[model samples]
Target: MRTATPSRAMRLAAVASQAYRRVFAASRLAPLLSRPNPVHRTGYDLDVVVRRIAHEAEDVVSLTLAPTDGYPLPAWLPGAHLDVFLPSGRQRQYSLCGNPNDRSVYRIAVRRMADGDGGSREIHDGLSEGDLLRVRGPRNAFSLVGTADAYLFVAGGIGITPILPMVRACHERGAPWRLVYLGRSRTSMPFLAELERHDGAVDIRPDDEYGPPDLAAILSHAPRGAAVCLCGPPPLMAPAQRIMRSVNPSGSLHAERFSPPTVAGGQPFAIHLRRSDITVEVGAAESALAAIRRALPDVTYSCRQGFCGTCRVRVLDGEVEHRDRLLTDTQRRDSMLVCVSRAAAGPLVLDL
Candidate 1:
């Protein structure tokens, strides 16, 4: 006596009705919608002065920031990142590598991407000590959960920034933890000196010396009930995830990715904005959000990598090929993040 599951069309219609009702109810309840909702706001923008800037490695610089107004900054936990608004008008997210107990200043490290969108370049060239900059969030998308088991941490290149604090926390708590830090070379790896303090618990594998890490062997040898945390390039993280899934079925492996997963042979599609009365062609090389921005320049977006939900839009019609990791299954059925999602079928309609 099992009930039949609703079809995709039926599900979408039901969701649309619910969304319409919610919107209508909100319109009638003026008070509820009138006041500024801080939750919907992007983040609290704070002005901070750069206290110090030092080179941690080749093309890697660490910046220490303190409040310009002499007030205590918001507290952050391990694996937190800050959204820094650069002088070049580009907003980028950087992991907080400094000690969490220290309230006097916050520190973050940056690696200059030679072919990036100029954010890291600005941090390297346009910034200096005593310079004021705007920042938002000490948000943690990859937080360490409370557990009694030992921990295994894997970091690649600049990915070590987030894991550094986690290692420190484990050390302070007398918890069992091991770190496998990988980089292209020893001279290019940041926080080597700091990690060397815990030599017994750290394995620094420079690619030039050790080739690639033996991930299969590492995961196979992981302690039972150990929580594995990984942060690195997609190429490395993708394969690591597969190995982790095979060896650890409990899904204790956690990973944080800064870049969007690469799509191969993406099909070109069209998006119709119902409210804006516009239809934009999304080329295979361009994203839906980019196409929309060409017609409507004021659209809000952050973290084009698709981790942030700042560019979410309601879907009125068409199947979505969601590419983001942020949305839950329920949310994905009705809405899509325009930054990374695309239409699975021909033309998709949006409630923009």
Candidate 2:
């Protein structure tokens, strides 16, 4: 006979008991853990000076960064992003929008969110040209594949940064590609004049003029074996995902989000901080990073989506259900990005 699964209350109770033991263990080992833990600086390796800052749109600014050493920076693909370290020690990720062929400098666009977590605000108000900023990898999770028969690019609001480079690449290669750029208005959208040079078909739909976008009608026109790339907010992405899965299941869909991606199928778990000697209970609906921040407010993190590898911590105990694509097999053996990854079973002991 199969064993019955534990109910939600039972599972929570078990987790609480485990948390108690974890707390006791942490306190017992407090003296031994007093030694300084080595800092994990995976993404930040290069220093780049801000060469220029141009207002791309009403609230968007594009920053061009050049190396201090006067060397060509590391080459990046179309959809790669950088982990930018601000003067305030806060980290934020931005997509590279410049021409990849030009190795002298890297460019990224930022849209100021008045109610955001202060990163964009600091960037808009505090940053200036010639300011030195440390940055990390131009890593790619949404790369343009050459093998696709055609490409359907959907960019919403300020999501045009990554798609801009991909469109340029396709145009240069004489490949078939179409872009549907959407925004609140022409004034708020960036890079319209730059996109005008491309003779390819581009549909610019502003909500003020076009009302709400009929995402189904737009995506239904995707050609067979088309690679559909979407970068937008949840309102655009959610429906687009449902429509694509139903209408264009044969085609592949790759997406990037300005906000953290929704965490699905997560179960409640506990994170035992080895150094802090505290236990953070992770809710099924929230990420472990969110829970830890409630306990330790000053923890450093860049992309909460697990691509930047900034929130990675050593897993001292418990099996981890690794979720991020950024970490290698060897890295997964010992550490996990708490922003996305979670405990495989029981409670986790983290060297935070």
Candidate 3:
């Protein structure tokens, strides 16, 4: 059976409707359909597969991570570090030691600390080559910036991870640089062979051979106006910081500490956890997080240096003595990082 044909007006109306829909879809109003380029994205959280893992030195192991999505990663600079979330639910930061130009993968070296926390031990023993790990930020708290006559890098033990990239950058730019790589022995230091390949002068002063490096002798090789970059344990960094000022007063000193910074003027304070109904006493030398951890052992925190906001808690009352470098003025009005910040006086009420 033959059906009746559509009227002319009805057919024209249908054609006009189709045209209007097409135009609207391509307009600015349809932003959801227009996907932004992933390359320009910043502060991205991703699950990356461990492509390779290798032992670098006596107690050091390096992990290479590749994006599971098979896309180029966000670009990073010399001193950028990644916040790695382990399968054990522990979060730790490791410096990027690989080439910055190569965006395909990131490389980080970890040294096992026998007496300290368990994060390093987890990476060295438990992490495998095929495991998937979540990571955030190639954020740089220690950036290699500004113009200098030359560069002097002092790396002790695993602190070489961040300064390795900075030395490579200086070599590529045809700038003068010297690295004083310090360790207990040559067998214990990572990247010793890699440093030899660079054109700059590398002084491998093992404590066994050199008998505790003389800061005066080390500074003698560096140019007068050179920028000094140092990262290491408190024993080495504490003295280097003092001598750098005396020897090269004209030079600029940039130091990064792996351990927690020493508390100078902190006074004893109290923190009252509102939800837990418990009060923790913060000692003059101990951090607020340390005190809280004793009362409540399951608190979440990473980078106890106050850069990561994992230990942040809402303040119910009391004036805060802010010491963190991450939070803004708006966020500081109601929040405080227990790892570094403390009460101005008396007791501080926290949301737990």
lDDT of 1 by residue, 166-195 (tens): 999999998999999999999999999998
Separately for all candidates shown, the number of backbone clashes (residues 3 or more apart, or on different chains) is 0, 0, 0
Write model 3 residue lDDT over 86-115, tens digit each, in one string.
988888888899998786899999999988
Candidate 3 Cα misplacement greater than 4 A, ranges:
1-41
Q: 118-172 in candidate 2: lDDT tens per residue?
A: 8999999999999999997776766777689899999998899999999999889
Sort order, lDDT high to low:
2, 3, 1
Reference-based lDDT, residue 34, model 2: 23
- Give candidate 1 regions above 4 Å deviation: 1-43, 264-267, 272-280, 283-287, 290-300, 313-336, 349-352
lDDT of 1: 0.82
Q: Which runs of model 2 end up more than 4 angstroms from their true locations?
A: 1-44
Which consecutive 10 residues in model 3 have the weakest lDDT in total?
A: 32-41
> Which ten residues in a row are the worst by lDDT in model 1?
33-42
Q: Rank the candidates by TM-score, best first.
A: 3, 2, 1
State which candidate, 1 or 2, has the greater lDDT: 2
